[model samples]
Target chain A: MKILVCVSKSPDTTSKIAFTDGNTKFDEAGVQWIINPYDEWYALVRAIELKEKDPATVIHLVTVGLPDCDPIIRKALALGGDEAIRVNTDSSDSYYIAAQIAEVAKKGAYDLIFTGKETIDYNGSSIGGMVAELVDAPYVSLATLFELNGTTASITREIEGGEEVCEVSLPVVVSCQKGISEQRIPNMRGIMAARTKPLQVVEPASIETLTSIVNYELPPAKAGVKLVSPDNVAELVRLLHEEAKAI
Target chain B: MSVLIFVDQTEGHIKKASFEALTYGAKVADQLGTTAEALVLGTVNDDLAALGKYGVKKVHQVANETLNHVDTQLYAKVIAEAVTASGANVVVFSHNQTGKAVSARVAARLKAGIVAGASSLPDTSNGFVVRKPVFSGKAYANVSINSPIKVISLNPNSYKTVAGEGTAEVVALNVAVDASKIKITAVNKVVGEVPLTEADIVVSGGRGLKGPENWGVLLDLAKELHAATACSRPVGDAHWRPHHEHVGQTGVQVAPNLYIALGISGAIQHLAGVNRSKVIVVINKDPEAPFFKAADYGIVGDLFEVVPKLTEEIRKMKASA
Candidate 1:
């Protein structure tokens, strides 16, 4: 089996967000980044698990970003990806990014393509479907449970009120979330091995971005908490009912 | 060309977020000088025309019993067909679980540019630009989709739903359901509880509650508020709570109207999941707990005393009223 898993970089959850150039660019001056948890923990880890189950399976990691994304690609490699491909481009447009991935998938004839259910940064979850559409393949998203059997794959996804289980064939694309697999930690040996693994960079195909960021703003600041004495519990109830009106 | 809204339903009743989508679609239609229409895949028990209060002029019902349950591919195919048949230039969906599952597929089938997690209505005044939350609600992105057909999945609770006195025309849409390529073998449901995704208010607990035995304190508070219950990832990882009830970056991301965190030290991942909530109340014994930074209200007291007292107060408020 030939599988391709997509990964991206996201700011560490605790990173304080700030923008530069009059709030037009994300301030990365003192921010720490990590491989998006969904991509690394769920999609890529599940693919690695599949490879572990079958020795003949080959797993490839892919990402579309500027050269700064190399470290994240290396992290995926250390996590058990056999090879890495970086599509050199700005991931500003969902369709454009999906097109680049579709191009790679078409050329490689990968049997399965995986992406995080959505990027933590953009939260779009748009690329996988567009890629599936561009490549004329079936798309299964938000898959929590997956099992591979010969040529058929049983996938379980979360719906509104319940879970829906389905079966599909290979050559399909999936956007996975939690419950697909437990996150794996790369060992010291794997980290050393990743340094030797090959990572190929391909120039991006020119595609137009349908969307652009015109501006960036933060949520309005919340008011200071109304601290009531523990003895004054009645006032707290009154405040919740009349002022907050949350109940 | 009109704006088409997908009114997601369960057991023949429309989901609350779908009403918000209807309002959003209708407002978008008004922006473009077009009409807004809604399409439901299966038969619903509610009076469909009553949805006109949200500004929708018409409701299109597929009336298929088979579609009562969600089939992502099937719904995408059906909605794509409905978009074509209705001459809709824009398709709107609430970016809830249903929208997350199927909207992109519909966008793919139509080759439409989709912007999910939209926080506001489009600015069609300048070629259809929409603003949405990004970076896990830390920043906003103003995206423009220059497509003949546009798909947008509005984030739940982002757009306030307005109801007006109006009536809609109910019409039946005709479409053939394709034989599903994938078969559904079973459906495991979380019954008799408010789903975390759709809850208006959420009351969550953490390891500070001591153990699973003390979960009743949080559950009691949750019941008093008519809110769903959730837990931090540590509580879930330790099996103190079910995984579905877990809310964090690794768990479910929710944006309820009010989120009350009891005994949870606010981690960034947990905040990312619930920060989009309209109002947040944090109760913890530790004044230095990180969750207080993000909370709109904070009570530095033992939850063992605070939780029961709060629940009792709510119960008293209910009795007096």
Candidate 2:
């Protein structure tokens, strides 16, 4: 089985969010980057688990970004990806990125494709379905559990109030979230081997960029909290009802 | 230049978010000086004509049983066809599960630029610029779509739903659908409780609660307030609460009207999921807990004493009112 896992770099969750260039560009200065948690912890890890179950299974990592994304891809490699492909581009548009990934998936002819439910930066939750449409394959979003049997895949996904179980044929695209797999740390051996692994860079497909950021705005800072004595629970309730009008 | 709104339904009932989408779509149509229409895919039990109260001029129903459950490919195909037939330049959706699953595919099929989790209506003064939350609500980005056709999915609870006087003309749309590659086997629905996404008030607990046995106090407060229950990642990881009730970056993200935290030390990740709440109240013994910075109101005291009193006060207040 050949599986293609889509990976992306995201700012560390603890990093303070800011924009520069008249609020038109993200401020990368002093921001730490990491493999997006959903990609590393859930999508890629689940693919690695599938590879572990069957040694013949091959896992390939793919990302659409500039050269700065290499370290994040290497980190994913250390977790168990066999090879990696970088679609050399800087476009963050979801359609452009999905088109690039779909191009790679078409060339590779993989049986299954995986992506993080959404990048923490954009939280669009749109790429997986877009890629599936571009590749003309069935797509599933928010998958929590996945198991492969022969040519069929049984998947479990979270619905509004509960869970839904579904089955699909091979060559399907799935966007993963938590409950799919546990996080894994790369050991010394894997880290050392990742340096020698193949990292291929390909030119991005010619696709029209759809959306552009006009400007960015930070959420307004909170007014200092109104501290109430714990003994005055009624006052807090009254304040909520009167001042905040929240209840 | 028409506006088409996708009305999401499950088990034949329209979702709350769909009403917001309809209202948003109508407002957008008003902004564009066009008419707003709605498209329903499944066999719905609700009154289709009544949806006009939300401002739609027409309701288009497919009346297909197969669409009752989401098949992303089929839904995308049908929606694309509907867009083409109706000559809708702008498509609207509620950024709920169904929208997340299908909107992008429809955009791809139509070669339209799409924005998910749109927070407000478009600014049509110069161009169509829509604002959306980025970095998980830490910031906002105004995105400009240059495509001739555009798709937008509104974030749940972001827009208000207003019902006015009117009845839409219900019409039947006939479109051919192919066999879906995916098949549904079973559904396990959580019953008899407020869904976290739709809750107006949410009461959440965290590691400071200690154990599952101590959850009754938090539940009691939630019950008194008629609020949904949620927990931090640590509490969910430790099995103190069900995974579905976990609200954080990796769990379910919520934006309730009021979020009351009991003993949670708001981590950045946890805040990412819920920072959109209209108001926040934090209660923790540790004065240094990060949650206090984001809270509108805070109490630095033992939750064991604070929670019961708060619940009792709310109950009494309700009784008096």
Candidate 3:
């Protein structure tokens, strides 16, 4: 089995969000960049698990970003991937990123494609579907468990109120979320092996983006909590009715 | 110009997000001085024309066995064709899994400006700018669609589904659909009394409920309210609830009408998921719980005491009604 796992560089989840340049762009200053947690924790680990199950299987790491992202790509290689491919360009937009990934998948003819349900940064959850569309394949998001047999893959996902089991043919796209697998850390041996793995760089495919980010801003500061006397339970109800009007 | 809404369905029935999209599309159609129409793919046994109660004037069905399952590429192609055939300037989607998949594909195919996770109707007073949650529900961004054909994917539960009086005219479209690229091997459903996404009311518990054994109170309240049950990430990680029921930054993002949180401190990640809920009620013993800051109503008491009382009161009211 050949599995392609998509990863991206995003600001760490704990980064203090701030904007610069007249509030038109996110300021990356003093922010720690890390592999998106969803991709790192679920997609990568799941790929490694699949590879572990089949030692001959190839797990390739793909990312759409500048050369600076290579360290994380190499780290992924160290984790378990047999090879890595970096589309050497800043991600243009979701479509552009999907197109670049699709370009690689088309040439490589991967049997299965894996990506995080949504990047922790953009949280668009669109790329997996977009790539599936670009490649004219089936797409499933938030797959909690996935297994492969012959030319088909069986996946179980939570949908609405129930768990939904779905099967899709090979060359399909899946976005991984939590519960897919426990998070894995790269050990010294895995990290050292990643240094020797194949790291290929390719140019991005030509594509036009349908949308662009105008700017980003932080959420409003939450108001301090209102503490009502524990004995004044009725007063709490009165405040909810009168002040909050939420009851 | 008309607005065409894609009504996504599963198991021969309409998805809840589709209704929310229908309502959103209808309101947008009203805003654009046009009527809303629907294009339903696959096989649905429901009354197609009766969807007019949600403000659709006509229902277009393209029932092919191939379409019983969704193929994003094929669906996008057909919808783009429908938008052209119907002369729809505005297209709306539900931004759910289906909507997230197909909307961008349709937009790319048509070169239309696309906005996903739209929380409200466009500000048509000026140019077409739609407000959507950005930074994972932490902020809002108003994006302007410059393309002639504007696509908007409404965030689920962001808009109210208002019922009105009308019947739709069902028209079967003669579009040719290709063979499905995907196959459904098996559908293992986790049967539950309530679906978390479709639930009007959701009751979520966190680690503060102490252990999984103490979750009886939550189940009692959820059962009384006919509400879906959810848990925080920690609780799910601790095996207090199924991982599927975990709703937070790393879990499901839901927007229900009423969200009741018990024994959960409002972490930023958890808040990111449920901030879109219309109403939040927190029941926590801790007076300093951060969730109360965002809650519209909060009860300062132990869940063991408050939840049963609330459930009993609700049950009494239900019995009387």
Report model 3's TM-score to 2 decimal places.
0.91
TM-score of each: 0.96, 0.99, 0.91
- For candidate 3, what is the lDDT? 0.81
| Residue-by-residue lDDT tens digits, candidate 2, B1-321 | 799999999999999989999999999999999999999998988999999999999999988888898989999999998998889999999998889879999988888998899998999888899999999999999999989999999998889899998999999999987888889999999887778887889999998888999999999998887789999999989988998899999889998889999999999999999999999999999999999999999999999999999999999999999
Off by over 4 Å in 2: none
**B200-307 in candidate 1: lDDT tens per residue?**
899999989989999998898888888989999999988999877889887888998889999999988898889899888888899999998898777889989988
Best-fitting candidate, measured by TM-score?
2
Ranking by TM-score: 2, 1, 3
Model 1 DockQ vs. reference: 0.60
lDDT of each: 0.86, 0.93, 0.81
lDDT per residue as tens, model 3, B22-107: 98899999988999999998888999988999999999888876787666778988998889889999998888767877887787
Report the lDDT of model 2 for residue B169. Answer: 99
**DockQ sort, best first:** 2, 1, 3
The CAPRI category of model 3 is acceptable
Among these predictions, the greatest DockQ belongs to: 2
